[model samples]
Target: MLSEKSEQFLMSLRLELLKRGKKEDEIEEVVDELRDHLHEAEQRGENVDDVTGGSVNHYIKTISKEMAFDKRIIKMVIGALFAIVAFFLIPRMVSGQLDLSMYRIIFYGLLTFVLLPLELWVLIEMLKKYGNSKKGYIAPILVALGGFLIILAGEFLLREYDGESVIVMEASTIFWLGVILSVVFILVCLYFYQWFYIGVLVYLVLPDLFANTMTDAAPGSKEYINVSTAITLILTVLALVGALAFYARYKKNS
Candidate 1:
């Protein structure tokens, strides 16, 4: 029997190979071979990582390097980069607060270009390590939140050091931006036909939904506030549950 982690690694490998434009027959052959090797290693009570010779990232990099340059890989990577760039810039552009100064551009560029991918890689590793557990379901959300907080912290530090030149946007702008971003994310996930991306959509939608509800709620009314909070919490939980259920079903069927 193959271990759950080995299974997850193989699934990820399949996706990576598919992105690299491997033929279906070839992918199936590669995955079958890997599955057999992993199962044999498990039967021998050997570690999967030791048998594979490295981690999931290492496998991805090795395979990518071995393959010819793939247009699918390029398109997928570009799509992701566009999504990330649009996610941050759209709201600022709509709200008219996007500073184009060299220093400001450099600051945002560093966060977008460097730290964001680092954060994503860390989360991917965590997901690979905890795919069958609750942590796997929650790690995506945590990673998204962690990246947001890091950006905010970076902004705060920039303000403290250069108070006159910091970038700031209204809460309302962010709320609307979040709504737009949620749609973009959902579309990307649909295009990719992946169930787990729903978790990301749910996490992104929550704050904006809550903010919108709170804004519409009657001020100075404890009952209204309580109702708004309750609704937000309930909806958020339902989204998460739905996403997780779909992911579990997808995993089972796949």
Candidate 2:
């Protein structure tokens, strides 16, 4: 007879393996193999509940009581970089660059070269350390974007002023403000802060980021208005997967 624990474990493993591109036909055999392996370990007093519960954590805790601290530090550092890029690079993109011919090159370079790498690094680290952490990073993104909005607002207002526009000063202030915001937002997200707020924010931002598409203005035209549509779509899909995985893990753990 299959124990309830074994049944749940096999089901979850099947789902997870499917998510990772496994075929249905092979899942049962793989599951049986897994059962055999665990049965061997059971002889030594290990149990399915222990591995699913906190074997991973027990291993990490033994290695470093400070893994949590290290993870936090890494997140904060990435958030800081994002804040800097948002304030400076965004303005450079909107009004065009002062020193570079292609504002896009600099703008996207910051996003690609600096911000994106950091984002991925933080994401990977989050998965490694706490793959079960909060799925909704929306509030944090909104909070960061809000800081950018203020900068955009100030840039708008400042440009209209009778006094000469000081690019350096404007950039510096916005950058710092964004940094402060990222710090706060990241901390909250890590702590699993406000679910409704985060979900609402994600809903609002996702379409803008992912759903819109570049289109040929006229049929048969080769013009592509925005390829960002594709990129955003990918993010949207990944976000959905992350959300589902988080929910499943949350339910299982709880």
Candidate 3:
């Protein structure tokens, strides 16, 4: 067995390679080779630092440069776009509203194609630079908070825009579209074994649906909206907690 530090180094290298879009098979092969090498080195009374020439980050970069980018990144991007569309549209479809505006399209496009990827890249760079230090997390946390605030502001602006709707579907059409999207989303998630994302969708959409049925208040009234929002928030928190617990258990078992 390798020392904890060596294991952590290998894990970090693996993550960095993943962020760099290296092939999953190649990453595992590299990791396995490194694991064996590290094990042998540990047996000889050497440490991870000695193996990496005292700079693990440099070693990781060197390895990353030698690996080719995976072509599956294109499929991953398409999947992400589909997921984002489903995430936003499913809730609106539940409310029987399918209003599409140019402004909304542009804003969501920038958010999905630019901001989210930029944030992920920034986070990956931070991870590569700072490793597992607490201080390293502070910058990424701040960036995420800023992004959240920007999203909230954008949403507020969107609601107040008074723009002409580009497309407005009838209730029946919206319902069918929602059903199709939901089926596709569920099937894709199941195929990929992405149970956490399915949980997120359930927590986000079901609360609103249930609140609408349970609350006596008018659908668009402040009271009804508040009840729905509260329920959604509660379920979202529970989903997050459940996901974290599951991840911890998975890691422990692995």
Candidate 4:
């Protein structure tokens, strides 16, 4: 039961507040205050609704269009999707094909079950706290971890499903996963990186898993595995460091 004149005044004030960059909650508080004022006046038996000005609803509509860019729902949507994806990926790691390179399976499985779930939970938490952007760190770290885990899981599941365990199998999986992990870690470092740093760490740490596979890559001998491991480790670490720095800065800025 707001008076027409008071309602119009409130509407104009709301528009002015919007232009001044007042937050949604602030504007809403003003609306409640104006409503209460009108209520008090009406309680006195005065027709404040007929006091003067026109309808306020149309003005409210005009102001709505300007505040459209302050949306936060998209981040929450992304968080939910990340959680669902992590959940689905976890069960797939334990499929019958996980034992090929038991180490690979172990690595990916641990990351998927452990790190991915952590990322998912944190993401959900962040979504719930949409007003805060400090949680953006969760994205990059999970992404880095995902890079290594995904490739390791794939190699292990695929090779184990096919029932292979030769040096060749280990070597192939290591080299490939190393490359994949390194790239993923770099990306994780650069953007939503809280989890992606794991991928970079995996690249640094996973080379020892394939002792016999490297000599074949160089045709020579002694330095083959050592050189390969070093290259992979260096590249992955650099990527992780750079991307992680960027992500950290972004979070701070947000």
- For each candidate, the alpha-carbon lDDT, in order, equals 0.65, 0.46, 0.78, 0.51
Against the hidden true structure, what lDDT does model 4 obtain? 0.51
* Candidate 3 structure quality by residue, lDDT tens digits, 140-248: 8877997898889999999999478887778657756766677778888999987767876776677556655676665577877887888888887886898899899
lDDT of 4 at 162: 47
* Best-first order by TM-score: 3, 1, 4, 2
Q: Given candidate 3, what's the lDDT at residue 131?
A: 61
Worst 10 residues of 2 by lDDT: 92-101
List model 1 lDDT by residue over 32-76, tens digit each. 988888888888888679766656557666555544544565666
Best by lDDT: 3
RMSD of each: 7.1, 15.9, 3.9, 14.2
> Model 2: residues >4 Å from true position, as ranges?
1-44, 47-100, 133-254
Q: Which segments of candidate 4 are over 4 A away from where they belong?
A: 1-118, 130-225, 237-254
Write the residue-wise lDDT of candidate 2 on 1-254 in tens digits: 44545555655554444333344455556667667866765677777765455343343233233212224445555655654444444333222222232433344455546655555445443334333325334434644575457546655654454253234344335435434544454466557554543443344333322312233232122332244344446667887998899999999999
Error (Å) of candidate 4 at residue 244 is: 8.5
Predicted candidate 3: what Cα RMSD to the true structure? Answer: 3.9
Query: Model 4 misses residue 149 by how many Å?
Result: 13
Clashes of 3: 0
Cα deviation of 205, candidate 1, in Å: 11
Q: After superposition, how far is residue 106 of candidate 1 from its true place, in Å?
A: 1.7
Candidate number of the best TM-score: 3
- In candidate 4, position 9 carries an lDDT of 61
Q: Estimate each model's TM-score.
A: 0.51, 0.25, 0.76, 0.26
